[model samples]
Target: MNGILIIAHAPLASALRQCALHVFPDAGSALAALDVEAHTPPEQTLEQARQLQQQLGMPHTLVLADLFGATPSNVAAKLVDGIHSRLLTGVNLPMLMRAICYRHESLESLVSRAMMGATQGVVSVAATAPQNQSRRTSHDQDQHDHQQ
Candidate 1:
């Protein structure tokens, strides 16, 4: 199975991992997270990420980062080689959950699934009632008599 790794800003990575764990309690072994603390050296963060990836112990890993050009992504870029692992930016709860759910698939396929989840999860919700149910007005009256 492909392992999943989350590398993001402080607390975000761990929080995303927690969300995945909430949905799939048995995913601890196949998943890991690294929160890049502020002021920490990139080398240190990269090393920490390497350790987490190794601990996953899977043939391939999918690394998810919060932003494309930020510290988390930079560190992750240095960690992935494009063969055994791949990196995807703009990580979200939906993306992470999707990765966890499809971790047993090929690394390339997992990346596609994660990307789809991230993009598809974001949407413009309607302000009106769900399913377009009409709202009741004062003009509406009871049709049945209650007297017994």
Candidate 2:
């Protein structure tokens, strides 16, 4: 199985992991997180990442970081270059959740699935809502006219 790791600036990595565990309930062991603090030396952070890699154990791990060029991503990039892991940036709840749901798949497949989730999760709702909202608005106006 490919273990999952999330790395991001302070709180975000852990925060996302916490939310994922809340949904998965049994993901505490399979999924790990590393939160990068401003003062934390790169070497120490890299060490922790090494341990996380061990904790996950196995063929590979999928490491997700928040920003591509940020500290969290940079630190993670260092450790995952090893054969046992792969890294994807711009980690989000949707991607994490999707990955957790399908963790048993191959790392490459999970990467594609999770990436789709992350990309699709980012969207803007139409300025005008669908027909349901329009109908509700019309009904509300009719009620107001009746009261008058």
Q: For model 1, how does the per-residue alpha-carbon lDDT over 1-148 read when each residue is reduced to its tens digit? A: 9999899999999998888898899999998999999999999999999999999999999999999999999999999999999999999988888888888898889999999999998987645444567654555487432332
Q: Write the per-residue lDDT of candidate 2 for residues 82-148, one digit (tens) a residue.
A: 5668899999999999888878898888889989999988887545434545424564534432211
Best by lDDT: 1
Query: Which residue pairs show collisions in model 2?
Result: none
Candidate 2 total steric clashes? 0
Give candidate 1 regions above 4 Å deviation.
129-148
Point to the candidate with the largest TM-score. 1
Question: Residue 145 error for model 1, in Å?
Answer: 32
lDDT of the candidates, in the order given? 0.90, 0.86
